[model samples]
Target: MTQPSRRSSQADPAPSPAKLARVRTVAQDAMRGARWWTLLDLERILRADTEFWRDLWAPSLAIAAHKVGLRNARSRLDEAIDAGFHQTDLFEPELSAAFGADPDWQRVIERARANVPVPALRLTAWPEPGPAAPLRLDRAEAHRVPQLLPRLPRPGEGAWETAKTLLGWTAGLWRHANARINAGDALDVLEQVANGARYSCVEYSIVLAQGLNALRVPARRVWLRRGDYHDGIGQGHAVAEAWIDDLDQWVLLDGQHGAYWADEHGKPLSLPELQARGHPARPVHVGARELMKDPALWAAYFAHASVSGIAWEPKGFVPVFQDGQVLATERLVRDSADAYPRLSDLAIGVTAIGGAPAVELKPVHPYAVAGSWNGETITVQGRQRFARVLDREPGEHRAALAAVTPYGPLASRELRWTAS
Candidate 1:
């Protein structure tokens, strides 16, 4: 007993160099991404409620649905949902549908819908779009975006996935031909392509852009030119870009190649972003067969030497042949306001229910509606369509709805009402 009592307290071992290095790298990455400055951000930081923690842990939460066979796939997905990877739409359609009825999966979707975070909103109000020019939203008959939308294959969820699916469908419309024939509008182009007319990249972009517009996603054709475009030797290439409300950024879609570009994090990169980064892009192909066989060939096509000038066509329906009607020059636009002047020109309908404190919100354009009522944040993503009914306590209710545009949320005109 005397010998045992002589033992001294033990000290903990120091962390190994490898462990210290990994920790430093992770911390550095987190700090670089936080970029917090505002007073609200400070409070969130103090409360440890910033999305930084969620963002940091997102990669580890990624579920490889492909690794598991069809038999075990459902259980694996259930496990993933229980672990907090709520992005079920990211999964393959077959995989998700095969086991969507599971209680855990259904619960996760319900929870995600209930806890939808508020989008960034403008304080102006609904329908009173500011000084910006209005977006020429496609008439249902004008582009046939409605008819074509359901016909198109939407394998995954979200705006980005739909754009990629449309790109693939557009690229497969016809074989590539250098012929300069007029493809007319997107519908006309489809009709002609079906009748054995091979078109160029211009037709591909035209169809892709129009297809996205039908889905309430703003998009435009991008005309890429070589530095010596004036020589008229090599006019340039044509591609498309769509404004994804989910990512809140313009993502390049090459319908001609059935591909799109992304950064290290799999975030789709706009054409200008690719140019700024010396076109170090990772191409994501959507089609069963790639338009460009060699992956390395894509970088060369988008290189500064190959594509020096970038121009965008005006929104709405424009004859593919009349593309040159709009001026073409060297311009690198990343700002959503500049890229899409009419983004805020959204069509919204607010209707009151008889003698009730509730109002029905109908947004013509697709995407969710986020806003506040008496300082309480609310975001509504309807299943039937982009419409929702909001109810508040009986009193004078001051509510504002924000349209979630690719350029960010713009506030709508404030609605004032008294409920008894």
Candidate 2:
């Protein structure tokens, strides 16, 4: 496939001297006594034209900031003043002076200060949720495969058997439970497996690797910070890619979810479908130390626990922000497993609770809830408030609710009336 055009790196004209002075001040404060420049701090100082900063100065600044050893340094706004970097407007005079003296840097700063492009507003209808398949991969099969996880195959042996094994495991689970096999059900099973276990994406990947190994499949963990389509933020995601003999190319699999790889319509997805969206794809290999230093990666990876099938690429890989400072440099991972659980599990539960009775519900997290039921409807609040009743009996009521204003439905539960 043809690569997308790279964003332009041409610098715009410098901002007014006064504005430049202000920017310099912020940069000085950000850089004073600090070892390096943080993408977040730079972003805050140059928030006016993020696109220009991202496209033109961001790359250079990212390198420079890291070189300066400011990635983990605390903000030095106060120290900038002590160091004569800050001016009357609490701006960095040194940075201003640097810009005035260095034509090249001046040009970059100018471009970085340019106006941002207003995104075009377009209205697209949200697609309807697809049907939920039963939990595939029975407990016994799940236990068996993990124990029998095959060794990493030889380079030329291919990953088809591994893929088939995963598929068979999931199919067995679904069939045993008499449940339909769909994307959502697959996620539920994975979530149960995770069970609040705190493991790095790599760790999770390792677990999956073990399972795949037991099944004699060659698999590797892929990781990266993915950009969001709706919001221009970067978060981490994980996926397993296995070599497939049939396709003769490595196919991406949601190891966190079940084996059946389907889109919203339940149609199977190819490798391309499982890749990242928007940005050029890069392989992710993170060590334990790096993962610990970057906790946002974990949060980012898990944020999409409720999304549908995978998108081809990340929306973008902007710097991660925390308390107005760029805490982490983010890149969009093409294959993310983190989004699977959130999107698939809660979505299916909400669908099951559709139109159920209202009850006295108390939500634990914005994503989960518990409540007492009444004779009519079951009421619950989580990501959103929901009520439903089964068709067979009035006492059989269910509700799904979200604590916070969610993009869609949240927690779901069903309860039947008991003799009082």
Candidate 3:
């Protein structure tokens, strides 16, 4: 037998300075028994705090630099364990915490070592299923569009009529073929709408979904990762899914791409095939750089293009009202500078008003006067506005004020009305 060539050994590659720093920080944190390693803890930390990232930034940059040279980040991480610079437990602290106290980790490692060969790939050989059953649109649903349009004068100016008018307008927009056409050509047409400041990717997706739902077309917001469409490395995409009843299957439509359910040959493609062609088996991490750039693109991707249904920021921050009372107010502050000016002023007013025990106020707006009661003091944004209680008696007290904004009345009923 030929003698084996002498193997040349080089010193193990040194970790990048950044990588070493990260490892040191993580190691230090782990030593301290901090809960920061847990996913739930991480999420909580991200939501309630922002400064944590500042602390981790240096380490993250270092880790990223080390990972840059590695063919596969995961593999490189594993190699670090083999080289004795790092332990597997360092990477998966959650698992270590779960099983380190017992022999579970060893048992798991042993079980994994005896792994059998994976089964061979098998094609789905079944024939296409029959077409789906016909779905009937109800009168209420069918007439939903017609009702949405501005109607002629009606008998009563009832709230139901107003709601019906609004619904009718919405329905008309959905039922209109042009609206459908606009959605069909969303890739091109939507940009114009965005330019007009009338629509966004999220709004467009919602409009499409709502339109379909109004027409009795079952549509859902599907989330998935698009591997190819990336502004930068490892940034995936998202989209929507609609259930086509006549086709007896779910259809993938790219509201952003303006592509219908058909392929190049105009043949309808199944959900699986569509996903295989566009979406990937694994999701790429959506980095801050991608989000900070054109958030609308990502928003559109998540709202209309995703296959996993885990889209980000689906709802616009609209306040919630329950039984003529404001339950909660939500506002989406895009830029801090824009938000601070308005919010700071409101905060000051609230502080000043709430500082007082009680005071009387006169009507400033017509809507305000209608709702004013004898003694009502309204608390808004931490500020208090008092209204006189006009009909205050031993057994009864009522305060009224005009409607404030669209949510509810302005004044509170508890304050004594001091008429001038």
Give the Cα-based TM-score of candidate 3 against the true structure.
0.23
Q: Candidate 1 overall Cα lDDT vs. reference? A: 0.52
Per-residue lDDT value at 83 in model 1: 44
Evaluate all candidate structures by whole-model CA lDDT and list the values in order: 0.52, 0.36, 0.32
Instruction: Mark the 10 consecutive residues where model 2 has the least summed lDDT.
Output: 282-291
TM-score of each: 0.47, 0.23, 0.23
By lDDT, the best candidate is 1
> Could you arrange the candidates by lDDT from highest to lowest?
1, 2, 3
Candidate 1 lDDT over 42-89, as tens digits, reads: 221222322322322222212222222223434434443444545545
- Better model by lDDT: candidate 2 vs candidate 3: 2
Query: Model 3, poorest ten-residue lDDT window?
Result: 341-350
TM-score: model 1 vs. ground truth = 0.47
Q: Model 2 clash tally?
A: 67
List candidate 1 stretches off by more than 4 Å: 1-151, 154-156, 293-337, 340-420
RMSD of 3: 29.3
For residue 378, model 2's alpha carbon misses the true position, in angstroms, by 68
